[model samples]
Structure formats: structure tokens, C-alpha cells
Target: MSIEELNQELTRLRQCLQQLKTDNAELRQAVLEYTTQLKQHKSEQQAALLERQRIEEQLQTTQQFLYSVIQTMPVAVFVKDVVDLRIVLCNQAAEKLAGVSADEILGKNDYDLFPREEADFFTTRDREALNSKKLLEIPEEIIRTKSGETRILQIKKAPILDSQGQPKYLLVVRYDITEHKQAEAQLKQQAIELEQTLKELQSTQAQLIQSEKMSSLGQLVAGVAHEINNPVNFISGNLTYANKYIQQLLNLLHLYRINYPNPAQEIQMTIQEMEFDFLVEDLLKLLSSMEIGAERIQQIVVSLRIFSRLDEAELKAVDIHQGIESTLSILEHRLKPRANHVEIQVLKDYDDLPLVECYAGQLNQVFMNILSNAIDALEEALIQGKLSHNHPQIRICTQQLNAQQIVIRIIDNGLGIPEQVKQKLFDPFFTTKDVGKGTGLGLSISYQIITERHGGSLECVSSLEEGAELIITIPVVQPKQ
Candidate 1:
């Protein structure tokens, strides 16, 4: 009985052991499957983590690129919250314009950054942009930096909207235009100066032309004067000789008539037919008249020669008073009373002066022109009823200024020039006289002659309703040309 039971128990034990072995094998297989699954899961998790990290790096790079673009932009860029109106974003250019770093300007409002007036203006514009909910452009806006530098800006303000289409921020972009404005202003000033220079050149060109014409005219007058001088001198000399010869003949005839009371019958008949007594007395008078006419012709020839001074080509030391006298003598008729007006009184106050070294011919011409102008002025005053207090007068005064200079003042009582006109008195082709009456070159030419030719100054002092005084200052010793 023991052997059978033992065998049975052993059989059961073998079966159990076999089952346990099978279970152990199954458990090992399960564990291997679980290890493979665990490794796969861990690999999948690592791949997901890498993808997430790559995505994060891309996002960071994109943000940095946007920041770099904003910082490097030429124009100043600023972002302000639409609700609180506080600066939220400031670019490098914005910081530069604000004269501060980004940290100093990032969270500041216009009121916090700018003056009260500028802040008010900027905020008002920002509000308008926000209200408009669109881009707003300001053509020009002035901004003062913390460094006290002023700049003009072209501003573009736009509202940044959220996904819900509501304004979230105001984006302000501004371009500085200070340098551009300054360049424009400089260009304008240069243009003005260039125009003035062009005007001066034109005036000088016209003056040169006028001087050439005057030189030609002077040559012609000089030639005419020379031609008249020779003939007038011959005539004057012959007339004097003829007058003396006639006087001698008359005396001899009177002596003969007294000695031989009874004359020839033919001579007495001729005398009686010719009204002898009346002819005798009239003959003497006629001879005297002829002599006087010859003398007057000689004087006119002298005056014309003096006025022209054609022979005096180079500079010479001469008396200034003589030059004035020659000019007055040449213009005596103009000064004398005409059928319509009274004679203009000329007063001379001449100092005892040394002989001035000058071009005598040109000096005489200057004196003539000045005296002629004076006469014209006096005549104009008389005609215009400006000589109410007294008659027209021209006073010419010569003074020895210093060892080096001389002064000649020609004063005239006349209707004077306006202040505005006086400033332009020396400009070529500028005149107050009528178009035909004045070439507008007399005073201009005179000024040129005195200033350029003689190194002198010709100045006029006058105002409306006041008399004019033309003071000429010249160096006594002429500078070598």
C-alpha cells in the first residue's frame, strides 16, 4: 500500500513541476516582451522630446529675428498700449531719437518722456490714431530730445488690432527730417545769394557799356572842340588886326579931312550918297562891334578847349578851382536867366588848397557833370515850387581835409531824393528823372569816375524835402594806377 501511494504522489509532483516550469518559461517570455515594449516607449518619448525642443528653438529664433529687425530699422519704432497709453515697445532707433536707452523709454508715456506741450500734442495724435483704428500719417512733427536737440519728424501711427479686431496697441514709426530741412534752408539761402550776385554782374556789365559810350562821346566832343579852337583863334586874331587897321585908317582920314577942308569931288559925292556922317559914326561902332564879337568868339573857344581838355591825356597836378571855373564857364548859359526862369545863384567857398594830382581832363568833366546836375536840380525845384523860402542856390565848397586828402562839397537847395532811392543812387540805370531826360547813368558814371578812376569817394547826403549835399573826398596824392 505504501509503494502505490508514494508513486501517485510522485506522479502528481512531476506534473506540478512540469506546470511550474512551463509557467516560469511563460513568465520569462512575458518579461522579455515587457522589456521590448518599455524600450520602444522610451525611444518614442525621447523622439517627442527632441521634436518639442526643436520647435522651442525655432520659436526663439523667430522672436530674435523679429527683435533684430525692429532694432536695426532706420526709422524710430515705438509701441504704446491703446488703453493706458503707455509705451510698451521701443526700438533702438526710437531710443536713439529719445536720447535714452531702451530701458529708459520702454515703459514711459509721452507725458513721462516729453515736455507738456509736446506730450499733449503727441498723445492727442495717438488717441486720434487709436480712434481711427487705421494708419494715420503726420507730414511734419517737431520733437525735442533730452539732449536739447530739435528734430522734425515724419510720423506714421497705426493701430495694432487683436484677433477680435479691437485696437490693442499703437505702433508709431517716425523718420527724422531735421537734416533734410536744414539742407533745404541752406539751398534757399545760396539761391538768394546767387540771384543777388547775378544782379550785381548784370549791373556791372551795363555800367561798363555805359562807360564805353561816355568815352566815345568825350572823344567826339574833344575833336569838335579842337576843330573849332583853331578856326576861332584865327578869326579872333584877324579881327583884332582888322579893327586896329580900320581905326588907323579912320584917324588918317579924319586928319586929312581936317587938313584939306575941301575933299575930292568923287570922294565927297560917294560920302554924300552913302550918308557920310551917319556912316562915319556907325563905321566906328561897327568896328567896335566886330572886335567885341571876335573877343566873345575867342572866349567861347577857350571855354570849349578847357571843357574838353583833350590834350591832357595823362595825370597832372592842377588847380581844382580852375577846373570848376572852366566847368562853370562852359555851362554859363544854363546858369544864366532864361526866358522862363531866373538865374541860379552859385556860391563858391574855396580854400587855399595845394594842386591836386589828378587827370585834369576827367576832373573837368566831373565838375561839369556835377555843376550841370546842380543847375538841373535848382531849375526843377523852382519849377516844382520847392523854392518857397528863398531863391534856388548852389554852394560849392572846397576844403583841404588832411595832409593826405581833400574834400569838395557841392550843396544845392532842391527837392531831395527819397531814402529808399538814395540807397540805390549809385546803381546803374537807376534814376528819378524822366525816361528821355535822364539816361540814369550820370551819377553812376560820376561815381565810377571818382571812386574807380581817382580813388575818391563821392557821397550824397539828402532826404525828402531836404537839400542835397554831394561830398567828394579824394586823396591829395594820387595812387599809381
Candidate 2:
């Protein structure tokens, strides 16, 4: 009985021990799984911590880069709070421009750093910029620095907007432009001075050339007149005496013929062969023709001498119409009809003007230049078919404008000058003629002679498809020098 009971207890104990061993194994597995889960969780936490650190470091680097950019910018840069309009940030350039240190400039309002008027202007602009939420540019502004130095600045203001589309700050950039403006003004002044100097040089050169030309022309014409006068005088003096002597011989021969009517046959035959009656008539006519030719030569010589006016150096009262007639005589060959060109007719309406006190030779030169140009213009018009149906004509009219002044107008019916060309007509070296056809100084010299030398005004009036008229007004009597 004792052995069976003991064995039953032992079995129960064994069952309990087996259950305990199973529970211990399950507990160990649970602990291993928990340790693995805890390691994984820790690894994930470490990675997240590293990512956060990297992001913070990158953000710090970006901030430093931006700060460097703002400080080193050349233009004066300022950042002001939108609400208070107080400068919160400024670059090194701004401090220098304001003539103050960053420590003194930062966190200061415009009123604190500038005059009341300037402060008001700056604040008004800042507010406008913020309200507009766009960039505003002021082309020019003047500001005085702390050191009392004045500066011109071009300013640009822009609003810094936040993500919510609201103005956060006002950014101001100013560029100094004082030096540029000064240089521009200096260059402009220099350009004006240079243009004046060039014009003076041109005028001087034209004067020298014209003076030499007139001197040479006068010498040549005087020489020609002298050379022709002697021969013409000789021929003219001899023709009269020869005509009288021949008439005396013819009268004596008529008496001989009458008294010796019953002369020898040989004498009669010789008289008939000689045609004595026709010979007497023809000889008189030939002598008359020679005298006329001699007179024409003398008139030409006179015209040449008058045109040259070599002796009239000093100012003298002279007939203006005489000068005009001499010029026409010199240009007579050109006015006549030529190959493929019609005659250029000249009409003169000259008033009985009082004698004008002037340099006679110079006045003649002006007439020559004006008439020559008119002839050229008429020829040009004919060549261009502008005067196809109408003949080319030039009309010259003179009048007494007032007690002291006189007016002379030269008009031409030709291809009229364009407004643009006519505006520069009297300018030196300006020409409408082809290269080598003109010297381009004729009208310019004439204008100078009338306006500067004679104290007058010269102007042209013309329009397209119409004729051109050049009016010259001068005082009749020379003013005391």
C-alpha cells in the first residue's frame, strides 16, 4: 500500500516538472524576439537623427551663403521692416554710402538717419513699394552723406513677399551715378566747342581760297584787256585814214575818166576788166565793216576791264546795274543755245537804284556766281526733262527796300531744289551737282560776300515742282568802318 502511493506522487511531480520546462523554453523565445525588435527600433531612431542633423547643417550653410552675398554686393542694399519701415539689414556698401558704420545704421528709421524732408521722401517711397508689391525704380535722386558729401543715386525699391502673398520687407538698392553724369556733361560741352572750331576753320579756308581766286582772275582779265586794246586801237585808227585816202583816189580817178573819155582802147579795156565802179563801192563797204569790227573789239575790251575792276580796290560808289551788265557779258557764251541745250533767257527788272558804296570787283564777283549757278540749274532742268514744255528762264529784279536798304532777287524756272537740299545750299562744300562738275563753294562765297562783307541777308525761297528765288538784301550806303 505504501509503494503505490509513493509512485503516484512521483508521477505528478514529473508532470509538473515537464510543464515548467516547456514554460521556460517559451519564455526564452519571447525574450529573444523582444531583444531583436528593440535593436531594429533603435537603428531606425539613429538614422532619423542623422537625417535631421544633415538637414540642419545644409540650412546653416545656405544662410551663411546668402549673408555673404548681401554683404559683398557693390550696390548699396538695405532691408527695412514693412510695418515699421526701420532698416533691419544693410550691406557694407550701404554703410559706406551713408558714411556710417553698420552698428550705427542698423535698426534705424529714415527719420533717425536723414533730414526731415529726405526721411519723408524715403518713407513715402518705401510704403508705396510695399503696397504695390512690385519693384519701383527712381531714375535719379540726390542724397547727402554724414560727411556732407553730395551724391546722385539711381534707386530701386522692391517688396519682399512671404508665402501668404503679404509684404514682409522692403528691399532698397541704390547705385551712385554722379561721375557718369559729370562726364556726360563734359563730353557734350567739348563736342560743342569742337564743332564751333571746325566751322571757324572752314570759314577761314574759304576766305583765303576766294581771295586768291579773285586776285588771279583780276590780273588775267586786266592783262587780256591791255593786250587787246592796243591792237584794236591801231586797227580802228588806221581804218578811218585809209577810208579817206581811198575816197580821194577814187575822186581823182573819176576826173581822169571823164576828161579822157576818148582815150586809147587799151586804157578802156583795163578799166572795164578792173570793174572800177564796183571796186569803188565795195572798197567803201569793206572799210565800214573793218571799222565796225574794230569797235566791237574795243567794247569787249571795255567789258573785260570793267569786270576785273582792278583799279577799284577801295570802297567807292558805283552803279550796280553796270556790274550786272559786265557779268552777263562775261557769261554770254554759256547763255546761248548749244548742242542739245536751249538758250537760257534772262529777264531783268532793275529799278533806278542810287549808287551803292561797295567794293566794285567783289560785287561783280557775286553777280557772276549767281548768274553762273542759274545757268547751270536751267541746263540741269532741261537735261532732266523737267522743262520739257516750258523754256528755262531766269529773272532778276531789284528794288529800294527802304531809305537805307535795297533788295535784289534772282529767280529761276528750273527743277526746283528740295527743301532738304535748299536748307543746306549756302553751307560750305554743299552741292547738288555731280562730282567734278562744281566746286560747291560758289553760293557759299556769294552768301558770305553779301551777308558778312556787305552787311546783308541772303535767303532762298522755293518748293518742289516750283521755281526758286534767292533774295539778297543789303544796305545801300556803307556804314562807317
Candidate 3:
């Protein structure tokens, strides 16, 4: 009985052991699978931690980049909360323009830093940009800074929208234009000053021309007079003796003829051949012609002296008729007809004028200038065949304009000047003639002499169809020195 029980118990134990082993094996397999799952979970957790760290670093970098971009911008940039119309951000340029720190400007409003009127304008612009949801540009605007300085600015505002497409903020960019405005004003002032300077220089130069012209004319007259005087003196001194000697010879011949009524045949033949009656008549005529020519020479010298008036620098009583006649004598050659050119007829209608109290040398220069210009006009007309039908002409008239003024008019019958050109007639360097043909300073110099030196008015009256007429009116009683 004991053997059987022992065997059975052993088998039962064996069965239990086998069962325990099976359970242990299954438990080990389950543990290995759980270990593999735990290792995979650990790996996944490490990857997730690394991903979160990278995302955090990227977010930090992006924030830094945006902050740097807004700060480094050159233009005056500002960001304003559209809802409250308050400033949310400002750049360095904005801080400089506002005369305040960027940190102080942030969260502050335009009303806090600027005047009420300026604040109103700024707020209005911000709201308009937000409402329109578009970029708004103002070409010009004036704003007072925190430093109490005014600046002209060009402003541009852009609408910054939210995710829901609602108004969020205004991004304002301002460009200052004060310097440009100031520069423009300066340029304009400089231009005005330049024009005035040009006028002054022209006036100075005109006076110089008048003085030089008179001096030159005086010297020329003296030289010509000295040259002609020698020839004239020799002829005048000998002419009296020559005439007396001829008269004496003629008397002796008559006496001889009277005393000897009957002559030798040879003497009669010689007298007949000699033509003694005709010979004696012609000798007297020759002497008279010499006297007349010498007289003409003396008259020309007198006219030249009158015209020069070299010593008349200051005011003097001068004969206007004598001045006119002297100018005419100098211009005699121009008035005469020439080959392929017609004579310029000058008509002088001079009134009985009082003795003009003026600078005589300068007065002579004026006469010469006016007369010369008139001749030039006539010549131009002739060259263009304009004077072929109507003869070239100049009319000079002088009269008492009033109790204290005298007027001299120089009118020409040539191609008329245009209104635009006539307006600049007396301006220095202005001319109607071709380049190098004229200096263009003659009339300008003359005008300054008549107006500035003598207290007068010189003006041109002309039209396109009718020719030019220059009028000069001088005070009869000049200002006392």
C-alpha cells in the first residue's frame, strides 16, 4: 500500500511541477515582450522631447529676427492699435522724430506727445488706413515734433489685419521733407539775387562805354585836325601873294599895250599865239578856287572841334543845333548814295530849344550813337531790298515836352522790330544784328548817359508793322550837385 501511494504522489507532484514550469515559461515570454514594448516606448519618448526642444528654439529665433527687423529700419516707423488709436510700437527713427525714447513712445498716443490738432490728424489717418484695409499715402503733411520743431513729411500707412480679416493695427512710415523745401526756397532766392546782380553789372558797364566813346572821338578829331592843318596853312599863306602877283602882271601888260598902240609884227604875232586875254582871265579864276577850298577846310575843322567837346565832362550850356549839325557833318558820307545802296534821307524837325545844361561830350556821343543807329537801320533795309520802292529814311524831332523836360525822338523807316525784341532794346548784350556784326552796347550806353547821368527817360516805341521809334526825355533843370 505504501509504494502505490508514493508513486501516485510523485506523479501528482510531477504534474504540478510541469504545470509550474509551463507557467514560468509563459511568464518569461510575457516579460520579454513587456521589456521590448518598454524599450520602444522609451525611444518614442526621447524623440518627442527632442522635437519639442527644436520647436521651442525655432520659435525663439523667429521672435528675435522679427524684433531685430523692426528696430533696424531707417524710416520713422510706428505701429498703432487701431481699436484704441494708441501707439503700440516705434522704431529708432520714430524716437528721434518724436524726441522721446522708443520705450516711452510705445503704448502712448499721438495726443500725449503732439498738439491736439496734430493728434487729430494722426488718429484720422490711422483709422482711415484700418477702415479701408488698404495702404494710405499722404504726399505732404506738416507736423510739430516733441522738440517743438516743425517738419514737412510724406507719410504712408498700411493696414495690418487680424486672422479674422478685422482691423488690427496701423503700420505708419514717415519720410521728412523739410530739407527739400528749404533747399528749394534757397535756390529761388539765389536766382532772384543773380538777376539783380546782372542788372547792376550791365548798368556799370554802360557808363564805362559812354566815357570811352567820348574820349576816343575827341582824340580822333584832334589827330585829324592836326594832320589837315599843315596843308591848309601853307595854301592860305601863299594864296594872297599869288593873287597879288597875278594882278600886278595883268596891270603891267595893260599899261604896255596902252603905251605902244602900234607894235612890231613879231610882237603882235607872239601875243596872238600866246592867247594873252584868255590866259590872264584863267589865272585869276585859279586863285579864287584855292581860296574857296581852304575856307571849306577851315569850316570842317570848326565842326570837328564843336563835335568833340573833349573838356565837357561836367554839365555845361550847349547849343542843340550845333550838336545836331556836327553829327550830320560826321555822317555825311553815310547819307550819300553808294553803289547798290540808296541814300538815307534824314529829316530833322528841331524846335527852338533852350540851352541844354548837360555834359557836352556825352551829349555828342548820344548824337553820334542815334545817328549811327539810324544809318544802320537804313542800310539793313536797303540790303533786304525793302528800301528799293520806299527810300530809306530817318526822322529826328526835338521839342519841349513840358516846362522842365525836353524830348528827342528818333524814328526810323525800316523793318519794324518785334514787340518781344523791342522790350529788350536797351538791355546790355541785346542786339538785332548778326553775331560779330554789332557789339549791342551802343544804345545801352547812350541810354544810361541820358537817363542816369542827366536824369531822363529813354524808351523805345515800336511795332511789328511800323518801324522803331526811340524817345528820350530829359529834365530841362537837372538836379543840383
Candidate 4:
């Protein structure tokens, strides 16, 4: 009984021990699987951490690049929140222009730094850009800085949209344009001043021409009056003598009637008293003198009429020689007194030429001015004793340069103009003569009429003590319309 029980118990104990060993093995396998899974999970977590760090570094680099680009830009750049109209971001240029730091300007409204009016302008522009979702470019504007200085700026504004396509901020770019505006204003002012100066010059020229014409008329009137007086006086004296002779002849006829009645004594007395032969000869002489004086008066009147034809303002063909001759005749009185003992010689070298189309009155004025100057030169020479009375001469020549041009040259042997004076001879109010004696506008006006009005040239060629030669060249044909 004891052996059988021991064997069964031992069998039970072995089965239990085997079961314990199997359970231990299964637990070890399960622990190894759980350990491998835990190691794999730790490796995956480490790789994820490194990837996160790498992405963070890339993000830092991107932010630095964006900051550098915004700072280095030349034009002023700034961003403002559209919702609250507050400055969101600003570059280095914008901060420099504002005279403030980015930290101070950020989240600040434009009105805090600029005037309300200027701030309103910026607000209006920003609003328009956001509403239209398009860029707004203003070629020019004025911006006030924190220092209360106004700066001209060319500005461009654009909207920045959010992910929902809604405008979130406005980007503004500006450049200084003050110098360009100032230059434009200066140019405009200069142009106006130049135009005014030109008008003044033209007016002065016209006045000079008018004054010269009046002076010429005054001289002509005086000379013509003197010339007319002489002939009129002679004619009056001759008529007076003729009247006395007519009375004597009447008395002689009366005596002849009385002698018919008493024939001898009365006839002899009347003949003695009347001086019949003398009376007849005196009447004939008086009548001839009157006739000559009348002829002289008529000739002077004709010349007077021709010399005063400067009142009209029309162009016509006029013979140059006739004009020269008329001018000489008008100036004859001034010439005669000086030429009395000098034996003045005149040389004429006239060519056959066509009549020039010009304002006759104006051309005559030119001739009078030139010829009068010549006469004055000769007189001055005589007074100064520069001439020795050895055939002192005045020469005039007219020649045709071509079919369309003619030249009139007036040369004298008087003292010539000085070198320094020659340059200003044709300028108004510049003259070599004494102040009261000459107005200094004769040559200037003559030059105007010839060159500006008639499209001609008037020039003087002279040397000290060598006499002067003035050449005037005019076109034969009229200028084109």
C-alpha cells in the first residue's frame, strides 16, 4: 500500500514540474517580442526628432533671407494692416525715410507720425487698392516726415491677399522725386522770362525807327522852307520893279495925248521927264528877271513835292539813281556852304539797273539818312582842316550784282570812323557826332529799313583817317510772300 501511493504522488509531481517549465518558456518568448517592439518604437521616435530639427533650421534660414531682401531694397517699402490701418512691417529704407526705427513704427497708425490730411490721403489710396484688388501707382505725391519736412515721392501701392483671397494688408513703395519737380518749375519760369525779353526788344526797335523818321522830316522842312524863300523873294522884287515900269509907260502915253493937243512945248517936256528910251529898256529887263524867278520857284516846288513822298506805306518799283539825285537835292543847302571853296568833286558810276521793289518812302528815308551823314562828314573834315582843298571828292556808284540784286556805294574822302566806334555805329543812341547835333539813330533806322524790312544789307567799311565807304545792297525782286 505505501509503494503504490508514493509512485502516484511522484507521477503527479513530475507532471506539475513539466507544466511549470513550459509556462516559463512561453513567458520568456513573450517578453523578447515585447522588447523588440519597444526598441523599434524608440528608433522611429529618434528619426522623427532629427527630421523636425532639420525642418526648423530650414524655416529659420527662409525667414532670415526674407528679412535681408526687404532691408536691402532701394525704394521705401512698408506694409499696413487693412483692417485697422496700422503699420504691420517696414523695411530699412522706410525706417530711414521716416527717421524712426521699425520697432517704433510697427502697429502704429500713419496719423501718429504724419498730418491728418496726409494720413487720410494714404488711407484713401490703400482702401482703393484693397477694394479693387489691383495695384495703384501715383507718379507723384508729397509726404511729410516725422521731422516736419515735406518730401516729394513717387508711390506705388498693392494689396496682399490672405489664403481666402481677402485683402489682409497693403504694400506701399515710394521713391524721392523732389529734385525733378524743382527742375521742371525752373525751366517753365525761364521760358516765360525769355519770351517777355524778346517782346521788349521788338518794341524798342519800332520806337527807334519812328524817331529817326521824324528827325529826317524836320530837317527836310527847314531846308525846303529856306530854298523856297529865296526864289519867292526874288520873284516879288522883280514884280515890284515891273509895276513901276508899267506906271511910267502909262504916263508916257498920257504925255503923247497932251502933245497931240499942244504938239510942241508939252511934248518936249514929257519926253524929258519920262526918259522914254530908258523906261522901255528897264521894263524889258524887269520882265525877263520876273520870268526867270518864276521858273526857279516852279522848279523848287516840284522838288518839294517829290521829297515829301514818305507818308505812304506801300511797296513799289523805284529807280535808285532818281532816289539818290532827289536826296542830294534836298541836302544841297548843307553841302553848298561847305563846298564853296573846297572845289568838291562828285564822281558817279551808275549802271543800267532794274527798279527795286521796296517801300518807296522807307527807301527814301534810308537814302536821306546816308547822304546827310556824308555831307556832315565832309563839313566836319573842312572844319577840322583835314582836307587841303585839293580836289576833295565824294563818290557814288550803283551796280547790279546779279539779276536779282543791286548795290549802291557812297564813299567820301572825309575823316573815317574810329575802329572802336565802327562796331557800335549801327546801334541806336550811339554816334560819333556831338550830342545835340545828332540823335544817333540815323544809321540804326536805315539799317533796319534795309535789312529787316527790305531783306537787304547795309554795311560800313572804314579805317582811321582813311575815309568811309557805305554799301547798301537790296534785292531787285520782292521777297516771297
The TM-score leader among the candidates is 2
1 versus 2: better TM-score goes to? 2
Model-by-model lDDT, in order? 0.85, 0.88, 0.84, 0.80
Worst 10 residues of 4 by lDDT: 335-344
Q: Candidate 1 clashing pairs?
A: none
Whichever of 2 and 4 has more TM-score, that candidate is 2
Report the C-alpha lDDT of model 2 over 1-481, residue by residue, as the tens digit. Answer: 5989999999999999999999999989998888988898899889889988999999999989998999999889999998788899999999989999999998899998889999999899888889999999999999988888999999999999999999998999999888998898899999999987897688779768878988898999999899999988998998889988998998998898788878899988887999978888998899999999898788778888998998997788888888888888778888889887888888999998999888889888888888888888888878777786568898999999888998889899887789899989988888888999987788888888898889998899998777888898888898998
Question: Which candidate do you rate higher for TM-score, 2 or 3?
Answer: 2
Clashing pairs in 4: none
Ranking by lDDT: 2, 1, 3, 4
**TM-score for each candidate, following the candidate numbering:** 0.66, 0.70, 0.64, 0.48
Model 3 reaches what TM-score against the true structure? 0.64
Best by lDDT: 2
368-467 in candidate 1: lDDT tens per residue?
Answer: 7677787887888777766776577889999998999999999988887788988998777788788798877778778877998899999989976778
